[model samples]
Target chain A: MDRVTGHGADRSSGRRPVLTAARVAGLVGAAAYAGLLASTRPFTVEADVVTAVALVAAASAVVVRLAGDRSVPDGIGWRPYLPWLVMAAAVVAWELACFFGGARPSHPTLSSIYDIVARSEAAKAAVVLAWVGLGWALVRT
Target chain B: MTWRSVTFVVWTVLGLATLVVVALAMAGRGRIARPSALLFPVSTHPVVRVLVVLGWMWVGWHFFAR
Candidate 1:
């Protein structure tokens, strides 16, 4: 558990000031990419292009992870993951229930609520960027 | 009132509860592990890692494209 969780280490220790030129350029580039994606209509060629990029990136991540260090600690049972599993299950259950209940305005599923937020291009771009960043984080693990 | 409204309320509560749990974990509260702490080890397994990344890709496509 300690090996996996770093139970004794300072959790806040990793963060550092990374405001270099390359970091700034990377942030700006991501924002520009997200903005460009958001400008296109959904299901269109432009949209599909960005989506393809994400797909390719994720596929590469999987391949890299598989080809790299594959070691994992033994005997790390399911108990440690129970909290996340339960939370995810609860969220998904309600999403399904709401969808089955007709997904009307009165009973908005999470996606429906997100639809309203994503109506704003800026918000849509932010979410797109966040989704990409989250994928990278998960893949690096 | 209606079942729809009640369902919406429950969904809101679930969202809020999840947020609370994440907040607690971020704060380093006892018995609540950080999400990174949990996810890092799980992702070490190649199959689960692939599934998770694929799920993430699906989400991006579902919301942003199709």
Candidate 2:
């Protein structure tokens, strides 16, 4: 009951900021992406593109929400995240290109990209950039 | 049931089940609690990763296998 539902104020007192819709959306997008990646060839490249777009959009929504959230100040040191934001967009674009380039089964480059998404230069940089941004938020007033 | 049909249904069930469980679990936890507390903290971590891996493997088998 109370343990499962977390129906108290302390639930909001975690080290991290409260969960925002954007973050939730990002989680949903990730789950969907993972689930969809499993399915084989009946789907077209367009579907992959759609999945990528949805993920990036979900992530972008989180960024936008964070930026707009009143608790976050205008001069928030994390503002530098906007650049990483651009980089995130670029990563998604690269992913989309590789993923949807060919017709069925997608291009090898796309598979390679995903193969490394768990660990890739581009992916690593993007993830680092995001971490730096969050660090900025955490360290700043 | 055949393997193909079973795989689809498994994924379908897993995907839907995770969502329903997550939703109810999340909602059950007031929608504001950290997911860790809502779900079993230990099982939530590694099991989620395993579930993701297994879920995709199942989907791949469903889509491309002969």
Candidate 3:
């Protein structure tokens, strides 16, 4: 007998997908990170660091899960969505930091390290390429 | 060595290690695609998650928010 799974997989096994506590925690954490980023403005340095760490940790969790390790508790297979979540979190953080954190008038924010590099065309290109690489890696399932 | 020097050296080593890993991943020349099994404990442990989140908040408060 074939059993249809939410993943659209037909398997003979009768096991149904279950949502574990860990999975719920990860999803909630990702969502909270996104919400915080969206509503917060001129984030403090603390906010920047927390958001960065969360983004990195979530990304790592997703990577570990996708690399075929059963370590991360499966929850609706949310690992695939992690990269997008990370990217969104990062973009929001960056924009908020840049716009609100930047010094009054023309000075860039202290966290705007990219602005320093952007002064050099080659460095700017490198940074842009790095962002592209990051996007590519994150989007890969 | 001075504390600053020590910090510089440590950062340099870490930077080089990161570059090497990135290079390997790009080249598709190694089996480093998957994180080592050692990460399992950190990833799966509940206490660790709480501690990490707490630590993150602490760092943000102390260092970022003046």
lDDT of 3 at B36: 24
- Model 2: how far residue B34 lies from native, Å: 6.4
How would you encode candidate 2's per-residue C-alpha lDDT over A25-116 as one tens digit per residue? 75565555444433322246744553344334434544554465444222222222333334446555645654465542333343443344
Lowest lDDT sum, 10 consecutive residues, model 2 chain A, at A72-81
Candidate 3 residue runs with Cα over 4 Å from true position: A1-141, B1-10, B25-43
Clashing residue pairs in candidate 1 are none
Highest lDDT, which number?
A: 1
User: Between candidates 1 and 2, which one is better according to DockQ?
Assistant: 1
Q: Fnat per model, in the order given?
A: 0.44, 0.10, 0.05
Candidate chain B TM-scores, in order: 0.73, 0.40, 0.47
Per-residue alpha-carbon lDDT of model 1 for A3-122, expressed as tens digits?
A: 444345566667677798878887897788789888877879889888888789779867976887657645565654567778989988878877886736867877788788888999
Question: Candidate 2, overall lDDT?
Answer: 0.41
Q: Compose the digit string of candidate 1's lDDT tens values, residues B1-66.
A: 987679768977887988887887666533566666766664657777778877888888888888
TM-score of chain A of 1: 0.79
- Model 1 RMSD in Å is 2.9
Give candidate 1 regions above 4 Å deviation. A1-3, A6-17, A20-22, A72-74, B2-4, B27-30
